[model samples]
Target chain A: MTKTKKIPVSLTLASNRDKSDHLAGFLSISPWLIGFILLILGPMLASLYLSFTDYNLLSSPSWVGLANYRSLLTDARFLKSLEVTFTFVFVSVPLKLIFALALAMLFNTGRKGSSFFSAVYYIPSIIGGSVAIAVVWKQLFGRQGAVTQILSLLNITDANLIGNPDTALSVLILLVIWQFGSPMIIFLAGLRQIPIELYEAASVDGASKWRQFFNITLPMLTPVIFFNLVMQTIQGFMTFTQAYLITGGGPLDETLFYAVYLYETAFEYLRMGYASAMAWVLLIIIAVITLIFFLTSKYWVFYQSEGGR
Target chain B: MHSNKRLLSDMIFYVFVIAIGIVMIYPILWMIASSLKPATEIFNNAVSLWPSAFVWENYPSGWAGFGGIGFATYFRNSVMITSIVVVGTLLTGSIVAYGFARLEFKMKNILFACLMATIMLPIQITLIPQYIIFNEIGWVNTFYPLLLPGLMGGQPFFIFLLIQFIRGIPRELDEAAIVDGCSKLGIYWRIILPLLKPALVTVALFCFMWTWDDFLAPLIYLNDASLHTVTIALRNFMDTQGSTSWGPLLAMSSLSLLPQLLIFAFFQKHLVQGIATTGLK
Candidate 1:
């Protein structure tokens, strides 16, 4: 209680000021910070701890000690979902990245009303995963769908897309690829950020357009490209909505993604503890993949910022 | 740059882009056309760009008996939820963001970093505990769970967005406010708020869209038919629990899509900016 009301010593003064500021800051950010700790981080920690337990929502989790992790090692549905999600991630990420970059380059040209075109292409990304679009996709590809109608012109008929399990997943992939605008817009910005002088200098150096692209443009845009790759990869793995509304992981579990399985488990069955473990596993997978990117980033992610931000 | 080869490549590029555009746009175009097509002609004109006869009443009929309620009611519900959430998030999130951005405080970095990391935890992990928490609080079917969170400091994504945005504004504004005897809250309200229109618009647009399009939350919490949001109500109609009609179903969807489509059209500039800011971060 001997603390001075007005301390001249820097340590005491700074400490007192910090105490007030600390209390003030904690009080100020208490809403999200508290929610994060209590609602989010607490559960996140619980999920980590719960991953090793034999808990259900009905009872206290027991110290089963790596049983769930061990169980995952042998779980067929979990493994299949892992495969399904990986297939989705691999297939969708490349298609989206390629389509997005290609579209950006297309819109990059000085064409009349290019912004309008960019905007038009962007509509799908906005309306994405809505039951409406999925329903539209459903109608457009049903057995007697538009696909058949188009085939009627060639005297062909009765070929269905969504009914085929092999092709059912492909339709979901197409849906993912269709919403390429947000990423494409990012690519466009990256394209613009490239120095016009670099391209001009390359042209003067007798570099072909192709050579200039490979040697200069690619190097400059590598960081953005890498960023998009990681972001898209993680997002692609988490694909749920399109699969959920479109196929319902359908035509015999052809489209059952990890997240869809997780959702079904968590909400549909109310198997909270198992679902929590599943979520943590997904996090671990994402972490490992992101770690790989971070490790290999030095080899490829060419950050042009002042010592890479 | 216009060598025959480069010109040819540019032409090829245009064609390639146009092809991609067609691929991206064809489904949306077809969906709109099919909505106008008669039930009989829907499959008949599937690949055809133009419908032979437009059943425009298809919209009204398609939207029929949305959860035994009119599509208008559900639409109103969506509008209500979106507005409340947007305004609520704007007020609280921006103040919290300003505090994080400008305030000098101990453990500030630790707290903020913790908030940022919370962003990485997928929503599924939190859904169970959140559901139980709500159920215990007897907010099970109320707007409390959905709406109240926004009135708190929103998701970290928006907080981080506002924090980044607030940084670009000069610190001198806050100092000037203090010199003029403005309180900390006054600086946030009078000085910072007015200057933060673009960022606020960005946050508002996102809150509106996400809340509007949110099907999952309504699906989980809402049990009472009268209280159903458009997303859940619309989806419920698709499944019978009674005889389901496809024509009215598609019609109902179109009605639901209209508000969002209009919002997208009006605030696309802000939408693009918000997304760009997210990407840049």
Candidate 2:
């Protein structure tokens, strides 16, 4: 050693501080970094490779490049799952958002105990997809379900909604719409963020509620709308427990969501490679959808804080 | 006249809110009511709000569970797993989030972006490979596969949430502590940890609830009857081929929902704040 400790107190202190700071930072975040590599990145690469091979857990994976993807083009179940998933996403996201925003707007008028009401409304979203809830929903739509009984009171008979293929998906969609709590909460937050002065000025200028909403509220809420859109779309695609528990993808595979189908393929049928390909395709679809939104967001989404569009 | 109109509108508003709240809570209310009803009465008066006869035996029967394994075991397993996960998540999540929020290090931006991007990647895409990895390490059929990821900063959502929270805390405290010759770890341990109580509580509540409610992982990983979670135990009630006992099933489900309902009622403020804060950003 060159007797570095005796060189100078301040010099050693400053240099040692930087080293310690860097070391501490590394040590602090290293867990996540290591986890991200082993769990996320490494698995992703393996999944990509697995998509091209025919791997069952029983044996080693054997390569057959593009075969799984090619098969997907002709696979009827795969196409049906995509159709079901896309329809579910496209239909449910807007309705849920609309319902959430309407309730949020209603609550945003600053009524007494509005928070209590909002919390009550959020209960379904908290436990909507639990097996218990799903089972309860199944009973609610069964032949002698609460819905059927109510429909009977209206002089309508034999209202078997869950058993019928035509209306089963609609029942699930209704369940999704019912659990619009998070978006409702987020919308309430966004609604609060809109400046009260803008609304006051609009009213002073003799603007009607509808006109003020169109000009003021909608523009201010676009960012939150966009956020909700992306999240709800992903959630729509990932809906599994409800479909798996409620319908079990029955009545001609009407509600066989992409995720449930992929799960059956991977775990039940043990077609791991095929399922991996399906998973990748699902990922790509979401990425492209989200990318399109991001690309088009600049045109419509106004950020008043970000240089005023 | 305007004041009368406002009063009438307020009346309408209260009615509307109450009606909507009833609709929102009807299913859960129906479940509790049906749980108390006899097996025949469940379907007989499915539309009815109240049970004609209260059958308290449903709770004991449901708790007895299937094939000698009771709901007590499932509840015990859930509590054990969730407690471990919550503790591990708070520890790892706060540390990683603190690093992202406060520390200056190389690759920080890239790493942060990577963490954010992982939030978008569907868990299914990584499911197969992870299953293989867990199997390779002989962690399958054990809680290790389900529990270890949470322990090792696997939940990026919590990390992102805590990072947003940690960012909101003032840096003056850290600076003052540094001037007092505190090391980086010392500042984090002494000041940041205590200040992070609210966020930590939110994180713990969410972790516990999500783990308790989680069915898919426990389903895929734990094949043994003994290691089944509450969700899976509830699922087993449906899986048996014979005539399904709706009373016992609904009774157990109502019991299972107690924790979530209690947590929501008590932590309504924190829950609302947590979502608004993390989600809006």
**How does each model score on TM-score?**
0.91, 0.96
Residue-level lDDT of model 2, residues A136-253, one tens digit each, is 8988887788987898789865678888888889889999999988899999999999999999999999999999999999999999999999998988888888999888897799
Clashing residue pairs for model 2: none
TM-score (C-alpha) between model 2 and the true structure: 0.96
**Clash pairs detected, candidate 1:** B62-B248, B62-B252, B63-B252
> Which of the CAPRI classes, incorrect, acceptable, medium or high, describes model 2?
medium
Q: Candidate 2: TM of chain A?
A: 0.94
Choose the strongest candidate by DockQ: 2
Give per-residue lDDT, candidate 1, residue A168: 85
Worst 10 residues of 1 chain B by lDDT: B239-248
Please give the lDDT score for candidate 1.
0.76
Return model 1's CA RMSD, one decimal.
3.6
DockQ scores for all the models shown? 0.53, 0.67
